[model samples]
Target: MFEYTIIDKSLENKIILITGAGAGIGKEAAITYAKLGATVILLGKTVSKLEAVYDEIIALGLAEPAIIPLDLKGATKQNYIDMSATIASQFGRLDGALLNASILGELTPFTQIHEQIFNDVMKVNVNAQYLLAQALIPTLQLAPNASLIFTSSGVGNQGRAYWGAYSISKFATEGMMQVIADEYENSTLRTNAINPGATNTGMRTSAYPAEDKDKLATATDIMPLYVYLMSDDSIAVNGKTIKAQ
Candidate 1:
């Protein structure tokens, strides 16, 4: 669908929730979605960064954005429930969500990984996604149609050496996407996983400190995949893992 999918004003008046909206791909997605006419809800751990994105959106004269400062590692089920409730009360419906927030943790051998790091990665990547998705299901159902995207990774498809808990968490994410897609197969919700490969982001720099940044794509470069998934073009594309390189 990436090759021939046409971009249009399909997201006008839609409500989208994006985690990790503070920087990198999440920030770009928030701005792009807002420019395309979606009312973006920016959720991230950094209050200052989310506010910056919010200010940018407002300055662009795009649809106004909402902000939620949430630390996924410490997020409880009640946090998701409260978020869902707030979105319901404020927007009346949720049209899309991008589960893009994650941590790199310790990129060490499994035996060399600390227990806390592993737990933190799992909590942010896997558990938080489950809780958020579960809480937002009803809100999504209220929409005429909705898109839900889970961020995946190359290590998720085939575990890499020294990737440790981060890779495991992404694999679990792919599983979660598949399970949710299957459950909503006959419904109006579409769920899928996207691997945003080799992006020039802080996380990528941390993962590959020696690599030449110029050789990699920026967050804006892979945004077509994000937009296509959230737009009506990929409404029937579900339960699949896609690459955005």
Candidate 2:
């Protein structure tokens, strides 16, 4: 199963929304889904970056993508609701959502944790996810089968001393996934979390500047697990925290 290949049309006719779709794993997932024949809705804070991903999908003669410029840190519940309403109007149903947007607060000691940084991290990593999931539930229910994925971290499962707010936020993320998964266990909607471990991304660099980049897997290399989660192949997989590579 690990060696299985994701085919070109694996996601044909699917409609997927990806938060933080401007770069890193989110960007790659958006592109990969588009290539697999899914209509992708790219959401991020940067218009230029989202446009670049949009153009790339268009240029490939793949599904035309849509862009929603949003900063998760500042987004309100109403904003997510409005976005969901718009998606419902445009596509009728949402097939998948990859909640990949997260904020890594300063890695500091427990006693020295800054208040502002802690609030900011929780707002983006936890609050935003809660609002987004709440807003999109209806649209997701409209689909025949919907997949909701949360971006999790290793520190979330087993707390690390210096990981601080980022780790706490991810633990909350894992909790959110399990709660939603249990609630919708009998429905078509499935919720799960993925820990993209040791990926060569900006987040990793920020978290471990002294670490060797060559030792980590690239964002593109982790797409198989992501693709599997989003595709119908993993319909029975829900509420579990899966690691990428």
Per-model clash counts, in order, read 0, 0
How well is each residue in 1-245 modelled by candidate 1, as lDDT tens digits?
Answer: 23534355667899999999999999999998998889999999999999999999999888889999999988899999999999999999999999999999978987899999999999999999999999999999889989999999999989999998999999999999999999999999999999999899999999899999998998888888999899987888999999997
lDDT of each: 0.92, 0.94
lDDT of 1 at 1: 23
Reference-based lDDT, residue 178, model 2: 99
Per-residue lDDT tens digits for candidate 2, residues 132-205, read 99999999999999999999999989999989999999999999999999999999999999999889889889
Global local distance difference test of model 2: 0.94
Cand. 1 TM to true fold? 0.97
Q: Which regions of candidate 1 fall more than 4 Å away from where they truly are?
A: 1-8
Candidate 2's displacement at residue 112, Å, is 0.7
